[model samples]
Target: DLFVLPSYYENFGIAVAEAMSVGTPVVISDQVHIWNEIERSRSGWICSCTVESLTETLKEALHNRAEQLDRGKNAQIHAKENYSWNAIAQQMIKAYGEIQRANSKSANP
Candidate 1:
């Protein structure tokens, strides 16, 4: 399935993430922060929030079945690598360990 998120302004655009998580190719506005990653990974198409841009991008996506499937595969891999719960939890654990180490040092000194 193709997912389109043409928001004028978005903080995180969790919907795009959700779409990518399930291997769906997306067409999102450049305002989404994750657009860069999507573009780099070829997981989706990124365009300005204008109707013309969205229309053209959607047309390109729909016309190319092979590209769409390839991009969908990339989307799933990218989401698993970058946004998986285990990966995020590991990052948080590392950050908290650093915070704890700094606190301990400050307290002891």
Candidate 2:
């Protein structure tokens, strides 16, 4: 199955991530902030926000069974590795640690 969203504006597009988490291939607009990740992971198709683009993307995505399965698996893996709660927590912890290290260096120097 394919999840399609042609939003004109989106902050993070949590729904797209949710679809990816469930191993569903997606067709999302470039307006989504996380489109870069989707593109990098080969998890889905990205298109500009227009009827023509969305329709063309949908046509291409809907007919490719082999690619669909591959993309679905990639989507699941990408979501788990990058968007899961544990992943978010780990990122936050790493960021905080970096901040702490920077502060310590400044204080000592």
Index of the highest-lDDT prediction: 2
Error of 2 at 27 (Å): 0.6
Best by TM-score: 2
Give the residue spans of candidate 2 off by over 4 A: none
Candidate 1 residue-wise lDDT at 105: 100
In angstroms, what RMSD does candidate 2 have relative to the true structure?
0.6
Model 2: per-residue lDDT, tens digit, 22-45?
Answer: 999889999988898899999999
User: What's the lDDT for residue 42 in model 1?
Assistant: 99
lDDT of each: 0.90, 0.94
Can you write out model 1's per-residue Cα lDDT over 37-64, one digit (the tens) per residue? Answer: 9999999999898989999999999999
Model 1, residue 55: distance off in Å is: 1.0
Q: In angstroms, how far off is 43's CA in candidate 1?
A: 0.8
Q: In model 1, which range of ten residues has the least summed lDDT?
A: 9-18
